[model samples]
Target: MTIDSFTKLYERAVDLQRLMSPFITGHLVVEFLLRKLIQIYDVSLTQHADDLKHARLISLNHNISTITDAQKDALVGINKIRNKFAHRITHEPTLADLKTLFIKCKDAFSDFTDGIEQGLSEIDGAASVDQLEEWEIHELFIQIAYDLHHVYHNRGGDIEEF
Candidate 1:
């Protein structure tokens, strides 16, 4: 095949690399927050808790009675996307696969203002989450992780009566 034919493939590889870096690392940050939350919730827990993987930690995060079903879906969707990248080495996940999770995030976190009609990002481009660029989606993912991190940082954060 000609180099011209491979241009799209090269672009996709670049996109994946750029996106996956944040996706993987951000998932780790969120997982850390979840584990910390669980530990703080139950002080009797040991480092055995650290052995639990991302999904398990998410399951545990659910023990917080205030976490909504939609909120759990965002975490679950993040893990699902992480799994596709981590486990499906040969598979090329598409924007279609990601859009669903973006939708979940939008649903999961309703606190965003500027009105729902304006769509996901505050930055220019992509009027809707479905239209989010590769970079934009990762930005949203990082935001999710950062928001979780802040909750952990805020001490007896707004998540509960604690």
Candidate 2:
């Protein structure tokens, strides 16, 4: 196994982050992670895509023992946001949306929220739902990439960095 495959997925996520709406980008991040989990866990891919498409399902998979509880909760939160954007064309996440998402997984995400606030403090220090959403998506992507790399390395996968 090699990190090249994982790098490609991460690059796709970065590309999506640049060109797509937050909803699309966030959804893709979760989707990519789920697909990678399927590979890492050697889960059968012949099942209905919907059965394996959920981030929560990936998190709950017994073979995915590399991630922490907080990471699992974060994935679920991201999935919730993605689902909201997916099911409603008119849905634009507001401050209320952030609050709702955060509350759903408060114990797992409070530190993450604090970190976003700290990062924002270096800028204008004003907090907006849009800003929070953007930061959360960014952080989620980073975390997913990190966890994927960790799994790959632990499995004796080699990375060729150029």
Candidate 3:
């Protein structure tokens, strides 16, 4: 894929993260990551949630080493949440729901939170920078998605119609 297309995908994920429900945003971000992985590894994949699940297994089998264990766990959590929203008529993930998921996958998010905090401190904000609150799960997820995108691009992944 062209850099433009990659960037557009990342931006769309970020936009969804900012404005959509947590489940929807998480699903979109995970989907974006899966698609990027397919391109990165040149794997034949259909765009399905099951394919996304299998991508992780295939990556491990191929030794592609795409995501950390914590990231894999986080993706699983995201998928569960997305599934709940999709299958249940009254299911809507709240901020608290997302926060719990983040806590459950805290290890995966440590580097991202640290980087965001450092970046925030470097900027001149109205108030002194402190820890990111629980309500910032959306921002946290956005940064994580951005970092994942950079990882793929930095590792020389590109899209070319074949």
For TM-score, the strongest prediction is 1
CA lDDT, every model vs. true structure: 0.60, 0.51, 0.53
lDDT tens per residue, model 1, 19-110: 56666776777776677776666656537568878777777677663255777888888888888878653343455555566677767654
Instruction: Judging by lDDT, tell me the better candidate of 1 and 3.
Output: 1
lDDT of candidate 3 over 72-109, digit per residue (tens): 77667776776765565335455455555655455565
RMSD of each: 6.0, 10.7, 11.2
TM-score, ranked from best to worst: 1, 2, 3
On lDDT, the leading prediction is 1
Q: Decide which is better by TM-score, 1 or 2.
A: 1
Query: RMSD to the native, candidate 1?
Result: 6.0
Q: State in Å the error of residue 94, model 1.
A: 1.5
The reply for model 1, stretches above 4 Å from the true place, is: 1-18, 110-134, 153-162
